[model samples]
Target: MSLNFHTMHDKNPDIVASLARLHEHHFGARPTVITGLQGDGSDRQIFRLSSDANEPVIGIYGPNRRENEAFISFSRALHQHAIPVPIIYTYDADAHIYLESDLGDVTLLEWSNQHDDSSSVLTMYRQVISWLPKVQLTSKDSIDYTKCHPFAAFRREAMQFDLDYFQSSFLSRFLRIRLDNAALANDFNLLIAHLLRAPFDAFMYRDFQSKNIMICNEQPFFIDYQSGRKGALQYDVASLLFDANVNLSHSFREAMLEFYIRETMRYIPIQEKKFLTFYYDFALLRMLQALAAFSFLVFQKGKSYFMKSIPNALQNIAFLLTQDDCMLRRLPELRRLFEEDVLNNPQALS
Candidate 1:
């Protein structure tokens, strides 16, 4: 059966059709329907295809050329190194479509949301950390830090998001206040400088939050991990622990970090004190980036979900800012910005 490429809401039909053809050619039967799944920070779309009762399921991804190529290559490389990513069945590079074995139904986000006690959730997350050292060891030679954008680039992206969305929409349109405050801009610049100067580098998952991880067969399975690149080693750790969506407590996060350190030591030797420094610096950077993201989503994307999480994002940033000496120096300005724009502004708080 043929499917229209444009009729589907958020996917490229041409890619979908190509994937259908590829599946039919390989499996000798077409999928019943391509059901859309939640997406991440890219223009890619994911779909699951269910086959006959006796046959296994197939996972299809429609990513752009660069991302699609990287995922296909990375999956193969990681698979060779015993990482638990989805097994790729076939890839049609010309059409930007690839098929992989379905891991299972439950995502870490869904699993965590369902359980009242977070112990089981943390256990599974610890398993994920166990896998990271292997990921680091295997991909060490393959990971290209030069290809990965640096903290400086991230700061630029955040500023663009702020200027285009938060400053233009919220400060000007919503609050009727022109964003001509030089002092506020300077404070933001200082914060950006602090982030860029922070130290650390390793394979970064770019987006290693709960939602991107799946719990298949009671194990933490990673997804939306195609953006993995050379970055601060602690970036993923900070992303997972200080996640605005999951809201894990400080005590739990610290324990988890300790757990990660112990497990990572099994494969590689890392100094406890030096690793902690990276962890703190990366945490501060991640928090700042998230602050920019929350602001962008609310003011530019008109997303109310992100708006609700703004306070939590700010709190995380404040917590991290207080921990580091470099960030501590800029705490007064940061507090001023938060109070004036976030806390005191009742409308934004809402």
Candidate 2:
């Protein structure tokens, strides 16, 4: 019985054998229950494997070897810097199976849903914001850039990838909006240039939204940072405040942005005016990136539930397109597609 793997015998026997051995090696006994846990947007399988004697640990079965390497490497480095990330206990590289301390499942998104007080929620977000600079400035040098998945830094090509992703996934493929190709490409270049103007010396948590945050013991612990790389600080800040899930009001967003600037200035030299100028530019980029992701999930993966977020994302895009400093003004053809075609006709997106 000690060697017998529980629950996972049917899902993937090959992985179960390796995971069972790893579990037994660490806990000295077979897990009593290997309960399946939820996953994010990745193709990773997770479980809670535990027995009566030992505290439960999160079991992971990752299909992507490079992503696994990035997560494990960053986890170790972040842990060393006293960051509040989950600790990696053990892993079987060949099997793509690993174990880490479980932090429970209360995400900042869930926590926000449960708590409604403006002041309290603001304080909570402030706390989350306060840690971003520390995560960026402190543990950044310790992070092995080579371990970053796909790319080691947020470069022009990466930004273009997300833009092209949105265009392919939602605009051209789904909506079939006839945008001015030359103008669209011009606008993309302008946006990319504006984003890269900021200091790019910090760890950019590529998806720093609420759902990626875990509320453990009333403290914030970050996860899903395997996609992170060296990039401008404004992008992550924009990601958090402008998160589609919470959809913090503009006033609150402004207050939180101010708080972030203050927190960031404590550790690094932040030109407030310069940071604000580039903030919304990155915000637009983040929203479009998210829209691209949601669209891909719905259309390609057939996750129909993601379709619900499209309208809100489109609304955010519509707002950004109207701003004077937004790149949309510089790209009228793309702006017309959003204004007259996609955003104006919601049915086009569906």
lDDT of all predictions, in order shown?
0.65, 0.83
What is the C-alpha lDDT profile of model 2 across 159-187, one tens digit per residue?
99999998888787667776677878888
Candidate 1 residue pairs that clash = 5-13
| Backbone clash total, candidate 2 | 0
Q: Which stretches of model 1 miss by more than 4 angstroms?
A: 1-13, 53-63, 144-201, 298-304, 321-332
Residue range with the least summed lDDT across 10 consecutive positions in model 1:
146-155
Model 2: colliding residue pairs: none
Model 2, C-alpha of 304: deviation from truth (Å): 1.5
